[model samples]
Target: MNAIIVTGGDIDLSLLESYISKNKYTIVISVDAAVKKLEETGKLPNVMVGDFDTLADEKRLEYYAGLGIEIVRHNPVKDFSDTELAIDWAYKRNITEIVIFGALGRRFDHTFANILMLRKYKKLGVDITVVDRCNRIYVKSNPFILEKRLVWGKYISFFAVKEKVFIESLTGVAYPVENKYLDNIENPSLFISNEIVDDYMSVIFDGEILVVESRD
Candidate 1:
């Protein structure tokens, strides 16, 4: 089953609503301030996990408790971020796919850290993705097919998360490549700003690559 974790960051309400309505997420978790935002949408999370430092309303907490929502509290002094804790909780349940919302915000540090969390849990065998209004961010180390043309995010870009990443093949893109190498040592400008020219696209790569499918 898949799980969606709502985190404490800037969220695009329209996108959030679109995802919740169209996707059959098995479970939904709210982290700290996200609980209030999720509730504002007239929907309740299945679970709430966080230190609760940012959640100020005492009555609202009581209301959630009364509804029998599972609340997992953590010490504010802990090492992992609230979103990480929530992901760990889902991992413990043997969830194989997780989509994170509200991961991007005005705070660049937190946004960067959240993106790195994808690397930290890369070996957990879960397909994790961080989504916002204009972007879908994820890490890849193998071949995958972009099966359909995205309606929102039109441009696809790839960055080498490792020192070097060898792409076996890139097709169905405006600027296609065959057995290309995207290494930090070389000029890494070739892989950015690619657009889908066909019904689908495919990328096969070696090593870790960070993919951002986005639009203006």
Candidate 2:
């Protein structure tokens, strides 16, 4: 099944609205502060998951309860992070493709952790994406076709999240590379910005490839 997952990182409501309006998904799950974002946007999530630590006020918790939102609260001392818990919950329900919003532009550690978390779900054979106002980030395990869309982005970046990823073919990009190996680098700016030129692009790789479609 298809689902949209919103994490508690900084979010852009206008961007979120555009995505939701275009996609007809089965469910929407919010994590932590994303619940409040949904409230502000007049969009109710199907499920809300998080430990209430990010929320400062107790009244906010009560406010959610008053709205009859079913919140799955985890212990503050749990081993898995709240975002992990939310992903686990969705995976248990057999949700395959997940589009995540409000997942970037916050604490660097948290953002980095969540990006790595997306890789953990790769073995499950599910398509997961972490999105924000400027980018749609995802991990690619094998060869795939990417369609070009006029989103709020101009540059595309592909990094080998694992050791190395072999690119089979590329099109619709300014600096297109084919049959190349993207090695894990200390400085990732080498693969930071790329552009797409055609209607679609193809990427083939063996290990994990983290693709960031960004703007500016």
Candidate 3:
């Protein structure tokens, strides 16, 4: 029902393992250096996607090849990043739900780009989420249901990903808003630090916005 893509970024192994155990048939993908982490953790990925530059060990490469995992190598000089390639591969396979790990790290530019990729995948009708130890990030352009159990904490924030966003309404939350208008270019603090009160929270937006469910 979902695909887990691990990139060459800082990740929490315990959290990653919990996600892997949640789905029965989760397609696991490793990108470059992440392959080493997966192999070390005894969670061999089903597919490997990247330029192979970050994957320096030849023996490990051969080992995965022997295991018959799908390896998609691209040129290091390519246009798109390795994570984007992995996302595209999952999109082509008709995998609607994709959970990406190890995508948030020291490289601020890479993290920002990966976050923006959420918009592209959302437009393709694919539900993609970037998950790390402290936060779960996604882009929402339509109404979405958020189970309280799934929220990282009581704190959830909605920020306009685009220049402007039309918020239809927010329900079942502590600081509920009705028919709110948010424009990042004009005022970036329109919606900030909202809390969920009920068992579930519903977010309805007419335009694209970044939703961050985070915990301290």
Candidate 4:
């Protein structure tokens, strides 16, 4: 089972609802502004977290409270983002995989910050994915395999989150790489827009790389 977090980002309601209906999500967390959208999904969150500063439907929270949904409100001046706090809540309960929607919205700072969480939670032994209408982003360090059928979209990209990333081989894709070291600052676009040509794509890498599966 996986957990899903809905943040205050631009999301497709139909897509979100379809995902919820098709998957087994033990926990559903709606951040402040996302509460309104969550309600439209016809599903109640297991818990709601955030300060009400950006809430769209403030009154609906009370309705959720009346239905026994746990409200984990935090102070507006807190350090961590509401999404991060919600992630912590799930992690404490032993949920290792988390999928977040609405994270890649208009706010570049928030979107970048959410991407960084992929690295942070990875260190804490949790896999976090930030997904939206066109992209699914995550961080990977170890050698991994991506089966074509399981890939999120038509295009796949890799980025070096750190200063440098050494990829021994990137195979089973349209552009295969061998013994290549990519510099984050210099060659960030070198690994973007590759397509899986075989049944599976495999990557052997030495450092952390941000993996993006996107559709145009």
Q: On residues 152-201, what C-alpha lDDT tens digit does candidate 3 reach at each position?
A: 86589889877888888899898888887888877797677788889989
What ranges in model 1 sit over 4 Å off?
none
Best by TM-score: 4
Tell me each candidate's TM-score: 0.94, 0.88, 0.93, 0.95
lDDT per residue as tens, model 4, 29-59: 9888787798798877888989878874567
Q: Where does model 4 exceed 4 Å of error?
A: 56-59
Indicate the TM-score of model 3: 0.93
Tell me the lDDT of candidate 4: 0.89
Q: Comparing 2 and 4 by lDDT, which wins?
A: 4
Each model's lDDT: 0.87, 0.80, 0.86, 0.89
Candidate 1 clashing pairs? none
**Where is model 3 more than 4 Å wrong at Cα?**
none
How far in Å is the alpha carbon of 194 misplaced in model 4?
0.8
Q: Rank the candidates by lDDT, best first.
A: 4, 1, 3, 2
RMSD of 2: 2.2
Model 1 local distance difference test score: 0.87
